[model samples]
Target: MKLAKHIKSALAIAAIGAASSAQALVVDGVTWNPNALNDFSATDAMYESIVSNIGDVVSGYSLVTQLNGTASAVFCPGCELTMTFTGYQLANVTLMADLVTPDQYFFTGGTINIYVDSTPDADFTDPTTYGDGILFLSLAAHTMGNGYTLISSPTPQVGNTGNGTGYLDVVGGSAASNFNTNKYGFAYTGNTAADFLFTSQFQLITNDDGDPVCLSSVNDSPICMQGANTINGNSIPEPMPLALVALGLFGLGLQRRLRRD
Candidate 1:
């Protein structure tokens, strides 16, 4: 009996070590992360269109939920709001851009669209349909490394202007996030059905290698990455705050010690 228990412990340790190995998913020649493991729960997906043939789910992962920076965390109904996030990698992907050279850099990105409804009872359970929520905020983001975290400060969702359908316009950031790039946020003009970013973390994780999956053999191929993710759910300000960080903020001897989960 003791021998069997010792064997299990040894196996568990070996598994952990193996998973720690630096590994990512790839398809053909593109290294794209897959949300297959999480059962296709990518709220917003990113892709690189090299002139054409743009795949929506370029191995997408995770969902989104923002928090209000307040003590009571009350829902003001029509108060102005701002958003900030320490992003994370729900899945890993691989893709070589056409302009990417030996030492050149490339990009893969996603989007977040918002809506406003004065109904007072807005429901966003369905990001696609937004159950009861109306379109109000819409923004796009891009990343260069495995994951991204916005600057420690909060900005408004006024990027590119002439639009207010979406927000979280993080077009550029880095891996370690040791530098404050051109990361800015947006805000609602008069405020009403819109405020800071909403909700708790939720998502589905999957492999990105375009392998067999939960509903494979049905014709189409689903590509996902190997990793865990959050269940994407949008919401208004609740009483209690949600802390969805995994490994805490990366604290190296560098720039802003932003959250790296």
Candidate 2:
């Protein structure tokens, strides 16, 4: 009886420890464990373009005149970039961008689209055809010819930065499993005269509208969002721990019956 009681007590302690350890999920200083479900999104914008200059000024003895300053260049009208992350755990994931542009030109009109999914061994070859799970798609107007712009989506929706650096806290979900499983895609539309230049980053975080915690980049970082509430997926509990818990409960019940007898 004494052995049984001790076994039950030990099991109870073990269960408590497991629950406490998995209570909160933290990534890049952002707490993803939320009592209620929440979604966050943001975007960053920049500029990139090719330029060619022609003509020079010539001085005359009697007349003063300004010569030509004509230029022409080809820019990237539309392009798609996709990234697949493997062996990374994520939940309450937020799409982040750090956009950079040239000094003279800015992103006139375009959209930055984001897509995410947990399908194992998924392929993101073509944007038009590869449409499985899309979290959020954002749109923005011209920035009044500003050199740079920083923005976040779904929440703030519009950004008001001119340096081409911004952050957004968008979407919430669990981690993706399997090798080469998780995939992210980016589609960019540049202005008529110039192409947009920028870089993107992803982070695992909860709602930050009240208290914002922004990240510049999540590459090569051991931070990802995962679990229930955030990703609508079952958190895999350790079998050993569960088995031990069950055994402990059985011993406790047996001890009680013996006492009753």
Candidate 3:
């Protein structure tokens, strides 16, 4: 993370210091941009095969690190997100997690399935229109239990790219459960009403084959994935009240000193 970005984040949190406890369990407005990635390419009469095989590429990579990031302050696992990507192909995408607390988090049971524009690939990109194109992905609530659930929405269209949107929830436990989704990205477990707090800092990898419009790597490997993509800074409670308490005592002491003088 850059120093300026860190300052901005701190200031943002400070600005919202007095919002309320309920809203405090949230990290907002996090962004990640890869400094360098490879482009993609494809051969003649092989566009369809390339698209289908892109998943192979997407699955091979993982998010490496975050340029600017934070760890989760609270643990609530029933958290999920729908990330939208613009100017990028939809077929070759992947999500990775960084466990804040390994034993407490699980994203998609170790695997993430993709959706195109809110519909399953089988339906959205049917054999007819299943050609090559960019689309949005939606995260669904698949893993549900007393202590955990997933939440997510489709990303809207942005310019030529799609906007990704997602949600996180608390399924079980309380704010102090010490079990949080603040894993690398968005991965955790929660019970009904558990306070889930997550910091968006991780990777978004894409499978880029050798195509004219692909992201490639320096080693001639396609930029199959984007690592360490941060979003919605991790939400943590600010101890402003503790500071206020100390300040109040100081004020009282100062008043007493003046009276004695």
Which of the two candidates, 1 or 2, achieves a greater TM-score against the reference?
Answer: 1
- Top lDDT hit: 2
lDDT tens readout by residue for model 2, 14-107:
7776676555433222222322232111121111111112111100000001101111111101221112222111112133344543232222
- Ordered from best to worst lDDT, the candidate numbers read 2, 3, 1
Please provide TM-scores, in order, for all candidate models, with all chains considered together. Answer: 0.25, 0.24, 0.24
Q: Which ranges of candidate 3 are over 4 A from the true structure?
A: 1-163, 167-211, 217-221, 224-230, 241-244, 249-261
The global C-alpha lDDT for each of the candidates, from Candidate 1 onward, is 0.25, 0.27, 0.26
Candidate 2 Cα misplacement greater than 4 A, ranges: 1-4, 20-240
lDDT of 1 by residue, 1-261 (tens): 554455455555554544433132321111212222321112222111111122322222222222122111122234211221222212322333663422211123445333333333322221222223333334344332233311111111122111011223323222112112222222231122111222121122223763323311111223211122222222211112112111111112111322232
State the local distance difference test value for candidate 2: 0.27
Q: What local lDDT does model 2 show for residue 89? A: 16
**TM-score of candidate 2 relative to the true fold:** 0.24
